[model samples]
Target: MCASPVKKNEPDNRKGQAGGDSGPASRSRTDRRNSQAAKPKREHVKKSARDAALSVLTGVEEAGSYSNLKLNQILREADLPRPDAALATEIVYGTIQRRNTIDYYLAKLVTKGLGKLQPWVRSLLRMSLYQLLYLERVPDHAVVSEAVNIAKRRGHQGISGMVNGVLRSAIRQRAELTLPQGMTDAERISLEHSHPEWLVRRWIKQYGAEACERICKANNEPPHVSIRANARRQHQDALLEQLRLGGFDAEPSALSPAGIVVSSGGNMALTPGFGQGDYSIQDESSMLVAEALQPEAGMTVLDCCAAPGGKTAHIAEKMDDTGTVWACDLHPHKKRLIDEQAQRLGLKSVRTLVKDARELAGEFEPASFDRILLDAPCSGFGVIRRKPDLKWGKREEDIAGIAAVQQSILEAVHGLLKPGGVLVYSTCTIERTENEDAVARFLEAHPEFVFDPIPTTGWPESAPLEQAASGMISIMPDRYGTDGFFIARIRRLA
Candidate 1:
């Protein structure tokens, strides 16, 4: 979710530097100084929240950048105040989540097709429209006026005038801009929920019309900022108490015993306990993976495809940092992320490695670990609530490609587990091919492995629901207001 900001070379506007040096380099210093005054320098104007949001939207559409990563980079570079930063974050995410519906209304308002407009101009319209339509706190006049100012600054008067007219028309015609009646169910769900049409159809076929509609609707809602308590350092109740005492609207998560859902007191990562590694920011659904694995004290485990080390840390914490957990990722830098998380959480049992899980069987001793977690690469359909860009960025074809890779890794790691050792397969995706079907196939090809029911001894009464198989659990976003996740615990019966 981070990268170093790239610096572009500034164009020198001095005499000789202008238009490839017109022999002005030979001029005297006085002449060069006089030439500099010929053209006025551009003033350094700071970006408003709207401007920042527009830039983020444009970056996502034009350069195929990840929304969260681009927003973080821009916010860091701009160094805006907390309120403005919060506003920008809201505008960016809301605009993305409702892009289809906004664009629909804009198509009716804009004489020029939405696609024909410049990327930033289109983003400006979408961002402005989102605020005008959804942001009740901000006045309509303020939204219109600010959007026009941004247009004028970034583009010509013609563009600004077009933006002004379009926004004004949209404001006047807002009530009439509802989705037309008589559309198909998939189309209605797609437009109403701002999801891609094909996805809606696929989900409807998989989960039925009612459930698909619920899933799509839930994807547009804001993701809960849940954190897992570092049980090794602080108990769940104690951590929740500390957070509440510090003015955080903290409550225990119904999903996981160690999970705490913080409604307010923004950016829990910046809190003192997070810095001290008392908890790690994670989704409640994902916190279930380590629990599914049931990592015990003095056991050796493998965390395949571990990065940013959230789940690995959870596993180590479960073991009281007593067991040796080998956390492996394909990239060296990713390994560093796990190592850093381990250090911050004071988990001494975690050993980091830059190795691919797909190649683990060849390079490592066979039947070496007590437990293995194949948190495989996936299409990430289940996480659209957090990363809305994945909706527009991914295509239907990508699912099969990702599933093939998952199959390869699953094949590689099965041999690394000792007799009666457990292997937990998990992904932040809702695709059946990569979830239930993949596990079903793995079980079919390898008869030694069997899918066991997930341990639900302490789970609430409402936790279990219908599934394609008994061992796997596919928790939809709408089910428990958690990220869409699939977890299956498989064991090799030696």
Candidate 2:
């Protein structure tokens, strides 16, 4: 649920001091000032849920803030009741996620066209239309009434009338709404699933039409909150029991052995045993990265692009906290995140460093480690269900630029791996150019490295290991019900 924006009533606590006089005249003057100050506070209107949703929509649209980050900040500050917050969140994310489809409806209804309307007005209509078309629980009249009231507060009477008329007309014409005529299958899928046309076309070329549609549909759904039990502190069964005893609706993940799926937990940090390093919040797909590496008790490993150190800590945990795992990221601020995660998981083997993966060869010796995890930075198209805004935030051209960076990091880290050392290259993306193509190119250029299939013995039986013979695996969100990820394991030949 999206949280609504709140109009803060800043109470004027500045009171005039009665200077050395307890007389009625002096006290009356102070009281008058206090009364005047209180008047302004009452005039401050508490923003309605629609108003809050509008603020967040405009913030993401105009100011270019990430929707999830912006929404969380606003919700924390507004402190709206749970129901209002839920409505606000629903409107914000639902409208944004379905922007293309909503705009299609608006284009048919608005006489002036959607582009002609003011940005806030357009957002208002989109939010209203989203509620009408998608949210079955909310009544159309109530959504229309809220939009009109928000418009009246934010604009003139004519604007209010327009919003009211447009929504009412849309409600009347709901059955007639359809996508623009004469669209190709790709174009139709793009609008129907509310994804960019270019992205849809690219996916179609790679995964075919049916699979691409499923992927797009899955991206629109809410993601599960999956966590990995820290093997160093507690077993998976122990962590599951602890969470269930604490009243969390928890279940073991069928995708990863160490994973737990919590349907109704408030916050992971607030959960019992979190302070005692019982588990780490991670995706079921992401947990496989560490498992594929198969780190031993005394091995030296490098997580080249580790941030927030989820994989690095997992590696340390698998090693029974007895190995050196150098976790490095380019951003200096992220170093603390890795350190904090290591401290939370009670793993003493992880050491955080703020060095770019592309420049790792300059700081470390050649063939320095037994295992290296290169979780390269990518376009993040695979995790769109968790962060819907990513679909709009990314551009098709950005893929090539990111792929170049991934290749460079791969080349740089290739020399750092010890002969016969295992290197698992992974990304939270399903794009072939960034995953299969990149690995293919790396293998062609570096013949000394050979494909190392991810062993199935310790892996979850359900994990797709059929492709492991090629030293790579791809998990589709729709088929797996997890974040889409690509992992390729390679080994340096002695």
Candidate 3:
């Protein structure tokens, strides 16, 4: 991820022209015109699906953009056909998902090293190799050809030559590009699983090597889409029947009572049921949070750090829409997300607020709410399957930074909970310091809060758990075939 920009590519291109220009024909009038058009601007004459994917990848690496957001923006502007959009989407996610492994392969093939290349050149090579090694549908020659053409279109012949050389070498030396010998188990796992070694090492120390490997392996998988059955519209069984009638291969989630696992039948969000608000698309792991909060009818609840309001809506459904669920996020614009979900589900009890969760105590009287759900923000290592860019974008230092934010919100909300009322702290992360330790630190700092073990009497039998350490449950991604999550229940003990 070096910051080599197009300026660097120019010098290299000039050097390339000096060395060899593909024979005397390279100096022809047409060649001169083509080279001038390919100059500084490097505007693509044609944006193929691979070009779109490459643009998305470069934007992500250079601008520090989130993969999904950047991809959505590009797709909207590109307006490529559905099939082309789908292929671009697949390549964008797949290349990011396996970036580390791709880099390892590049290390073996590239003479100049990947970092020495321009940002787009490195991304193009990585994405091309990914399609070659992982995607079976695309032919190898097409992958190489698309990459070389993109390079030539955007750069001088020399840079295109470099991309072509590396990719062709990758094709020729596929069998020889095995993981380097004698790497530690963590290194091997990191390279094979395409995860950062620091993260892999953290998992090994926290969960042991075998479980760490399993977690990394699971993170690479394409996550199944899950949706919560909108209770006001229909019962879970009723919704399953609706899905069945709609030709969806759906089943009840093993982890959450309200969840439906849609393993097939295309994008569930585009289905009529979704349009009619019969269900809301969510992950099974996140579906567990509302149930864990256990909000009763006519009770007051606060969802600190609520955005795109998934858990907030579930809380409203659990309470039968007869209670006030204050869905608060710091950003004013996100209140629209909360409102949209409430309106879609025909929920009237959700009250949207634009207030910082850390400053929520100042916004409201202390001991005012019956229940509080502080789904505090963390490193989001849990949802790597869905957002692969997180693997490359997240740094080890970021964990501590986000953990501090989690702790502040936890401390701020502790006073807002009514005496003997429940406050469930949750995060979509497996880091112990962010999960168990953060909870442990809060309990020690606040004398009024005590551990409240979530009752397992009505828990799903298929979703097993041993016991909560300090009344906190850690659901690793590998444990339940769900996004990694940690849920801890606390009560204000007067």
Q: What is the C-alpha RMSD of each candidate to the true structure, in Å?
A: 9.8, 10.2, 8.8
Give per-residue CA lDDT, model 2, range 1-494, as digits (tens): 11211112211111011111111100111222312121111113576667667777877776676776666656655677766776777778778878987887788898888887766778889988888888777777899888887765566567778889999998888777766667886998888889999999999999999999999989877677788888976789998898888888899888887899988564466555767788888889999898889899999999999997889989999999987999999988788888988987778898888998999999899999999999999989888876778999999999999999999999888899999899999999999999999999999999999899886665566778687667788999997788999999999997
Candidate 1 has a TM-score of 0.90
Kindly list the per-residue Cα lDDT of model 1 for residues 12-45, writing each as its tens digit.
Answer: 1100000111110111223222221221123357
Q: If ranked by lDDT, best first, what sequence of candidates would result?
A: 1, 2, 3
* CA-RMSD of model 2: 10.2
TM-score of each: 0.90, 0.88, 0.89
- Considering every candidate listed, which one attains the maximal TM-score? 1
Q: Please give the distance, in angstroms, between residue 137's alpha carbon in candidate 2 and its true position after superposition.
A: 0.7
Question: Which residue pairs come into collision in candidate 1?
Answer: none
Off by over 4 Å in 3: 1-46, 468-470
Candidate 1: stretches off by over 4 Å: 1-43, 465-469
Candidate 2 matches the true fold with a TM-score of 0.88
What lDDT does model 3 reach? 0.79
Lowest lDDT sum, 10 consecutive residues, model 3, at 9-18
Q: How close to the true structure is residue 330 of candidate 1, measured as C-alpha lDDT?
A: 97
Better of 1 and 2 by TM-score: 1
